[model samples]
Target: MNEDEILARIRDIFQDNFGIEPSKVTPEAHLYEDLDLDSIDAVDLAIKLQEMTGRRIKPEEFKTVRTVGDVIGAVESLLAA
Candidate 1:
């Protein structure tokens, strides 16, 4: 899948799990700071991402993913690999 596809999937996951509106979930929006996602939410999101993408994203990678775009980029890189 492409970046936009990945972004849309992430948006859907965030909205479904956190009740976050898609309008508020911009590429630059930070997961923790902007979305107020707690640690448990982050863990859940990570699992969802792994399940959707079939890639095991490490916990350390989660620390680096600050924004929705960052997550898409990471997933794209893994998909490419």
Candidate 2:
């Protein structure tokens, strides 16, 4: 999927999983600082991402994700691969 599509999916995932509004989940929004996601939330997000992409989200692969855009980029890269 393209970046925009990936972002939309991310927004949906966050909203459905954590009740975050799409309007608040901007590209620059920090997962921890802005979205208030803790370590458990991050792990949940990884599971959701893996389900969405139909791929395994290794712990190492998820370590670099810190922002909404970063998640989108990661998903995009996975889709591309």
Candidate 3:
């Protein structure tokens, strides 16, 4: 899928799983600082993304995911793979 589609899915995941407002989930939004997500929340996000993509996410692949844009890029790469 495209980046916009991946972003939409990320927004949905953030909203449904983390109770975050969709409007707050933007490309530049930091997962921890902006979204107030903790490390456990990061793990939860990874699990949720795995469920959505039906693919296992490597820890290394997610290591650099700090922003919503990074998450979108990761999901896009996973989907493409």
Candidate 4:
């Protein structure tokens, strides 16, 4: 899928799992500072992303994700792989 589609799926994941509004899930939004996601929330997000992509999320890769755009990039790379 393309970046927009990946972003949409991530938006849905954020909305469904964290009660975050779709409008708030922008590319520049910081996963922790902007979205109020803690480590546990990050783990939850990774899980949801894994479920969506049907692929296991590597901890090292996930460790580098800090923003919504980063997550989208990670998903894109994961899907491509």
Candidate 5:
């Protein structure tokens, strides 16, 4: 899938899993500070991303993620590989 598609999917995941409104999920939106996701929520998101991509999401891979765009980029990279 393309970047836009990946972003759209992540947007959906945010809404479905976190109860975040669609309008709140933007490229610059921070997962923790902005989206109110705690560490546990971050783990849940990683698992969901793994499920979506059918790939293992390394804990290290998620360490650098902070924004909604970060998740999209990571998932896109894995999908590309």
Candidate 6:
């Protein structure tokens, strides 16, 4: 999928998982600060993303992902590779 499509999917997942409004989710929005996602939510988000994309996203990868766009970019890069 294209970047925009991937981002939209990611946003859907975030909304479903975290109860965050789609309109509030943005490329620069931080999961913790903006969405109020705790550590447990972070773990769940990673696992759900892995299941949805069939990609193995390590814990280390999440450490570098600070925003919704970062997660989308990481997933896209993994799919590309």
In candidate 1, which residue ranges exceed 4 Å CA deviation?
none
Which is superior by TM-score, 1 or 4? Answer: 4
Global Cα lDDT for candidate 3: 0.93
Candidate 5 off by > 4 Å: none
User: Clashing pairs in model 4?
Assistant: none
Candidate 4: regions farther than 4 A off: none
Each prediction's RMSD to truth: 1.0, 0.8, 0.7, 0.6, 0.8, 1.0
lDDT of 5 by residue, 1-81 (tens): 987888888889989988999889999999999999999999999999999999999899899999988998999888878
Provide the TM-score for each candidate, comma-separated: 0.92, 0.94, 0.95, 0.96, 0.95, 0.91
RMSD of 6: 1.0
The alpha-carbon deviation from the true structure for residue 45 of candidate 1, after best TM-score superposition, in angstroms, is 0.7
What's the lDDT for all of these models? Answer: 0.88, 0.89, 0.93, 0.94, 0.91, 0.85
Lowest-sum lDDT 10-residue window in model 2: 1-10
Error of 2 at 78 (Å): 1.0
Candidate 5 deviates by what RMSD?
0.8
Model 5 earns a TM-score of 0.95
Clashing pairs in 3: none
Which tens-of-lDDT digit does each residue in 1-81 have in candidate 4? Answer: 898988898898999899999999999999999999999999999999999899999999999999999999899888889
Q: Give the CA lDDT, 0 to 100, for residue 26 in model 6.
A: 88
Q: Extract clashing residue pairs from model 6.
A: none
lDDT of 3 by residue, 1-81 (tens): 788888898899999999999999999999999999999999999999999999999998898999999998888888889
Stretches of model 3 off by over 4 angstroms after superposition: none
* lDDT of model 6, residue 50: 87
Per-residue lDDT over 1-81 for candidate 2, one digit per residue giving the tens place of the 0 to 100 score: 777778888899889989999988989999999999999999999989888988887798889999998898888877777
lDDT of 3 at 48: 96
Off by over 4 Å in 2: none
